[model samples]
Target: MSQAAYIRDMMSDPASDLATGPSEVSSFYSNLNVLLTGGNGFLGRLLIERILRSCSGVNTLFLLLRAKKGKSSEDRFEELFDDVIFDRLKREKPGFAQKVRLIEGDVGQIGLGLAPEQRELLRATNVVIHGAATVRFDETLRTATNINVRGTKEMLRLAKEMPNLKAFVHISTAYSNCVREFIDEKFYPPPIDSDKLLNLVEILDDAPLQHLTPVLLGKYPNTYAFSKAVAEDVIRRNDHRLPVCVVRPSIVIATSKEPVAGWINNVYGATGIVVGAAVGLLRTLHCDPDMIADLIPADYVINNVIVAAWDLAEARNSNINNADSSKNPEIDEPPIYNVVSSCQKPITWGKFMQQIEDFGLQIPSMLCIWYYCFKLNKYEWVHKMYAIFLHLLPALIVDSVARIVGREPMLWKAYKKIHKFSAVISYFATQQWRFNNNGVLRLSAKLSPADQNQFELNMDKFSWSEYNYHFIRGLRVYIVKDPLHTGPKAVVRYARLRLAHYTLISVLCGIIFWLLWTLVRFMGI
Candidate 1:
């Protein structure tokens, strides 16, 4: 179907273009100004596309962007459309750029680095979506505090200044409170006071702060989780007179539907493991095979975000209209929605690995240098043994050959980076978290059938097997830059690689058996 036809089918009733009513979520956003941060990030880009394509009545979208790599925000904004992710949006609404207004600013800076005029313009904003944060797991404590903690505080401060503000959605990770095994739809006590920690980072130098990171992180696994937890506390401690709520989505992956199926941009978190394994680099991972792999697609998260903002606005309107009605104590607190899959549709790491093997082999990438095989080791020692033999030894041999051929030796360095990534992700992979998503489910239940069809969050009917197939195919096509047309050639290459791999393994086993037999003969057995 054409992009225009797809939008018509998804957004409105097939009978007419005027099927959208005032009660619909799209109507709720009609003529409302929206302020969005982190418009260039993975989820951020999808959110922008969804809002523009679905919520067509939005007046103006103010994007807060920072200059990076010597490129101005304007340059970045124009270049954003250059990405194929926007191809569908561009075709659906070629005039979408007219509704977007760029604001040059940085979230990490004071007052969100907004100019006086920019602040004045944002006063008309009705919706604020704060999605900016330093996502690096190993980010320095100071930097993480500045972006995740302090930046969130600044956003809340700015939201208070908007007289017409209806909803403020702060995007966070589900692992923010991984220190606890069970997480509910409410706030927990932060590791440290947001103010005190921010002050310490501000007062100390880089060297001393580096030394203090571990102590400051406390029970948290890394700065990303630690700082995000504090940022939640920042929201809870504030007098939230505005319609503000927090959304915590677990390990976001590719787009399962909308815009395009299996579309992904970056290789973060579990995506790295998928790409590495698909290309025949990653052979082993230190993880529990039975542990729940709580992964949600990007479209699901964005859909939840849009619906959550609408829900918040509706609740606020209800409370105002029925002042004499008794208030639910739950509404007084900032609502937290843990948008995760394990609570509803659970898939194990073993099943996840099997899916990768199934789909990755079917549509193998031409970039594959070896056979597709992986081991999920429950013990760290076993994982290390496999890594040394399967990862390090092969990398060393490859680099040595490259050096002899007068080419730049890079395989060893690449393996070193891969090892670092695996170590950072080991904490989450080895354990499971039980998330209570009653709030998320309740919110979905509130939507009408039409609205639910437009903004899907219910995972009971979701298909992981189908999603996994598209996910592996996406990694090969999008992330690995291998086109789908090359699948036939790739399959031929993969078969040869698989044969060579088993032959080498059989030869090694035979040699080891002969050695054992010779030792026994030497001992006069």
Candidate 2:
């Protein structure tokens, strides 16, 4: 169907929009002036598109963007419209772009570095959605803290200044406090105080800080998780009077079922592993097959965020007049929703891996034969040995060649850098953490059946076999792109190489058997 037709179908029924969930209070859609941070990112882009098409009565959407290399915030907003993700919006309403206004600022700076006009836009905003954060797992502590922790602090401070702000939603990760095996719906502060860590980071130089990050993070997997955990604590402590909600989503993957099924834009999460395995780059994963793989789609996450915001706003408003009652209304705290899939449906790592291998082989290309053979016969020890040899021996050989050629050996250094980066992420892939998602289930149950169908987060609805097909398709169309469509070419090259390799091995085996027979005959046995 054309983009216009799709938009009409979605907007024709307001109840079908995933964002329009069941709420206790009526008329929650009136006069919503939303200020969304990270509006240029993948999830942010989808959220904005959904809101514009579904929520027609929204007053305005103020996008918080930082100035890029040579482009101003206005220039960036214009460029964002050119992306295909917004094609649906462009078709639905030619002037839909008018509702979105860009506010130039830096999240790391105070008041988000907004000027007078930008602050004016923020102050008038009714809802604030903070989605901007450094997602890099191996990012430096200084940079991560600056963007993740301090940036959130600045946004919260700005929210405090907004007189009409009804709800402030902070996007966080389910693995923020992943060091613990069982995570419940409660705030667990980090071992070290957030303010003290921020202070130490502010005074120390980059070199010394990088050296101390390992010791500082301690039991935490990486700096990303550590910083995000600290950021959540900061939000909880800062939101004493205002209504705030924290959404902690598990390892976010592609869209399960939405405007487009299995739609993914980035290759950072489990999608990366699937892509690597499809191309024969990843062979043996050090993980249990039975471990639960907690992955929630980006659109589903945004849906929950909107619902949580509305719920928090209503909850806060209800608590306002009851301050003098015997119940002590001040004790009513903000709810921290764990938006995960453990309760609804849990997928096993082994099943996911098997499906990816099958789907990669089914794609129409010359690569299919090799991928098929790799999955059937050569995927055991041979592929693992080959990976180790290619990853390790090349650097050693290159360094030797470089020494002979009278040049510095840089290949080994580059390999070390990549190895270090992979090591940090491998921990999560090799282990599993249990996040109790009773709160998400309870909240979801409160929604109407139509709302449940619109915002589908239940794992029982996902078919691993079908999803795997779209997963590969999404990788080709989005992650790898058209220019890199070399699956057919790779299949041919690997097939010929494998043929030569097996022939040589067979001939050597025959010669060894013949030699053993001759020795037995000569010994007159």
Best by TM-score: 1
What candidate 2 gets wrong by more than 4 Å, as runs, is 1-27, 69-71, 321-331, 364-386, 393-421, 483-525
Q: Cα lDDT of all candidates, in order?
A: 0.86, 0.71
Look at candidate 2 and tell me the lDDT of residue 231. 92
Q: Give the per-residue lDDT of model 1 (tens digit) for 95-173.
A: 9999999999888988889899999989999999999999999899988999899999999999999998999999998
Residue pairs with colliding backbones in model 2 are none
- Minimum summed lDDT over a 10-residue window in model 1 is located at 9-18
What TM-score should be assigned to candidate 1?
A: 0.93
Tell me the alpha-carbon RMSD of every candidate. 3.2, 5.9
TM-score of 2: 0.82
Q: Write the per-residue lDDT of candidate 2 for residues 1-525, one digit (tens) a residue.
A: 333333233332433454545433223645688889988887788778767765546778889998878888788888887765566567666777778888889897756788987787678988888999989987889888988999998888888888988888899999999999888877896757778988988899988998899899999878899999999888778754677878999988876555455567776867766765555434444455677778777777977887777777766666676655347543355578888877666777777778776766655333322222222112335434543554455567658889999999886776565445445545666577877876677667776765566655445676667767766666655565532245567556766756764664476567668989999999998
Looking at model 2, which ten-residue stretch has the lowest summed lDDT?
Answer: 369-378
**lDDT, model 2, position 100:** 82
Question: For model 2, how many clashes?
Answer: 0
